[model samples]
Target: MKDAAFGALLAIQFLTRLPVPLACPWTPATRRWAARAYPLVGLLVGTLVAIAGSLLQGLLPPPLLALALLSLWVALTGGLHLDGLMDLADALGSNTPLERRWAIMKDAQVGSFAVLALVFHLAWKGALLWALLAAGASPWWLVPVIVLGRLGAVGLLVAVPAARGEGLAHAWQQSLTRRDLVLAAVIPLALSAWVPGGAWLALGLAAFIIVYGLAVRRAFGGINGDIVGAAIEGGELWLLLIAWSWWSFAMA
Candidate 1:
């Protein structure tokens, strides 16, 4: 029980900007168990963002409210996934061999491709949120989308072969067992019981997980931390797109 509690804290500590009052142990076993709690971290982030959006829904214009929500989203995660997205974008856009592309991803300096990807990513998120707000959709829609994003991350961690022999992803992968995946999946499974169109959403997420994992494998020969982070951001965007499209279809 104590180790599990500390594992949760370790996950929260590593994944978010939120300060954990308790010190989580820095150990391999702890990090391994920590992955199981990743979905819960997403739930926490999503719930807080939803509540904030609900409170601010009518007070601010849709545009500004969307901006505020987006800001909060980025602030909470400290742009960790965004940085990975940027790094991957730089690597992909470098038009070099895989080895050189990997090197570019390691570079500290941001490139034009990274800048462009950042703008597009932020713009799409803000635009989609603003549209949803204007349509009077419940901000609670964010809960599943955000939760699924991290679930996607966890899914990737286990599914993709670790490209490198080192780093956090590899260590977590090495420690993972099927039981660990079973535990990690429990959150989403419970969440599906309540989320609308849950079955369909699960199907979509599964497909994304499979395709995204393979794409990473083919492009980079396997997965790493950056690829997993990219999966999160990409998964979130896909969910948002689905929401917006569904709304449009219903209205049309």
Candidate 2:
């Protein structure tokens, strides 16, 4: 029980701007439980955002509310995953050799591709969120997609070989094992039974796994922390797009 509690705290500490009054010791057990707690971390993020969005929905217009929510999301995460997305984008956009690309990923500076990617990524998310709000969708509707998005990271981290010998991605890969996946997947599976269009969302997540997993393996030699973060952001967008696509079709 204590392990699980600390695992949850460690996850929050790593993934969000949540304050933990105690220092979490990193160990094999923490890693195992942390991997298992991935979905819960996402759930905590989603629920907080959802509740805040719900409360503010009526007080502001859709566009303003969407921006506020988006801003809050960034604040909560400290743009951790988005930074990974931009780093991966810079590496891919450079169109350089493997060695050069790896160097770019390691470089602390942002490049043109990173800027472009961040712009487009934010635009897309904001637009879709505005659309969702304008369409009278409840903020609660996003919970499952958020869960699946973070869960996607766990899948990639487990399935893909670490691209480099050092840094956050490789270290995370060191801790997680195949057995950790059992607990990681439990929440999203249960959510499938609760959220409308959820079973299909599960299929959507599977597709994300196959597509990004293979893409990273082929393009970058394997996955890293940036790739996992990129996967989380991309996974969320993909899941959101899926939900909207199906909903539009249903209305049509």
Candidate 3:
């Protein structure tokens, strides 16, 4: 139980900007333990966003509330996933050799493709979220969606080879295991069971795994932390889009 609690704390520490007052001896085993708790990190973020949205929904227009939530969302994770998305965009858009593309991803400067990707991503997410709010959809779905998004990272980290021999992915890959993957998936699966139209969540996650596997293999040769981050962003968007589409059809 103590290890589980620390593992959860370590996950929160690594995955978000949230203050976790506990510290544990950082080791490969520690990282492995924390990796299993990745979905819980998403759960915490989603819960916070849901509570905030519910509290403020009546005080502001849907668009404004969405904007506020979006801002909070980015702040919570310090744009970590978005940064990965941008890095992947820049690498893929460069159309260079694998070596050069890897260099491009490592470059700290933002590229044109990254800018466009971020703009489109934020615009789409904001618009869809606004629509959901306007439709009076329960905020409960966000928790599972967010959890599933991070669970996407867990899948890729386990299923794909690392792109580089060093860095966060390499470190994490050392600790990643089939058991960790199953542990990471459990919460999202349970949460999805309780929501209406939750099959979309499973569909979206399955689609992301297939699509991301093919695309990343072609584009980067393998997965890394950035690809994991990109996968999370894409996965979340996939879930939101699926849910939005389902809501549209039901209303029609």
Candidate 4:
């Protein structure tokens, strides 16, 4: 459990750029638990964003508040996932073959497609979050959704093959055993029980996993860090959009 906790914290540090100190030592054994640990990082990221959004609620206008929280959320993770989303977008927009697309992603320079994709993603996220706030969904609800989305991404890492020859995805490609999935599944499942209508949230997460798995299989030929990152962003954005839409309709 301690090792798992440390792995979780390490993941949080990796994902969010958090300044927490290392509580446990790193080891080869730690790598085995990486899949389980990754989502906990999302949990922390979501919690922080919700807190920021909640605090900013009274001070800023709805759109600005959402944008502020969204910026903080991306900055926390160093926009790591967003970067993936942009690269993937650029690759997809290209007319080249798969190998060529992968090569393009490796290029350090951002292309026009990447720039436009980043703008759209950030704009979409900002608008979605702003709508959620205006709809009066509790900030508490947002945190679990974030956790679910990230956990869903990790699940994808376990379920899919690596698209490239080597990278972070390759490291954990087959390393995630059954025990790892169990541990990864349990934490979020337990947390979901605590939120209002949380079971439905879990159901939504399941749907996301299914859809993401199919998409990854068809699109990337396998899962990579970029796809996982895109999955995380997609999960979060979709959940917020769902919540906002549901709440708005309920009020109407």
Best by lDDT: 2
Residue 87 local lDDT, model 4? 82
Model 3: per-residue Cα lDDT over 187-222, one tens digit each: 778888777777778878988898888889887878
Query: What are the clash counts of all predictions, listed in order?
Result: 0, 0, 0, 0
lDDT of 4 by residue, 152-191 (tens): 8777877777887798777766567667777877878888
Q: Which number leads on TM-score? A: 2
Q: How far in Å is the alpha carbon of 44 misplaced in model 3? A: 0.5
Please list the C-alpha lDDT of all candidates, in the order they appear: 0.85, 0.87, 0.85, 0.77
Clashing pairs in 1: none
Residue runs of model 3 more than 4 Å from their true location after superposition: none
TM-score of 2: 0.96
Give the C-alpha miss distance for residue 121 in model 1, angstroms.
Answer: 0.6
Q: Give TM per candidate.
A: 0.95, 0.96, 0.95, 0.90
Question: 119-199 in candidate 2: lDDT tens per residue?
Answer: 999989888888777876788878898888888888888888897798777888888887788779989989977887888
For residue 212, model 2's alpha carbon misses the true position, in angstroms, by: 0.6
Per-residue lDDT, model 2, residue 148, is: 88
Q: Tell me the RMSD of model 1 versus the true structure.
A: 1.5
Cα deviation at 123, candidate 1, in Å, is: 0.5
List ranges where model 2 is wrong by over 4 Å: none
Count of clashing pairs, candidate 4? 0
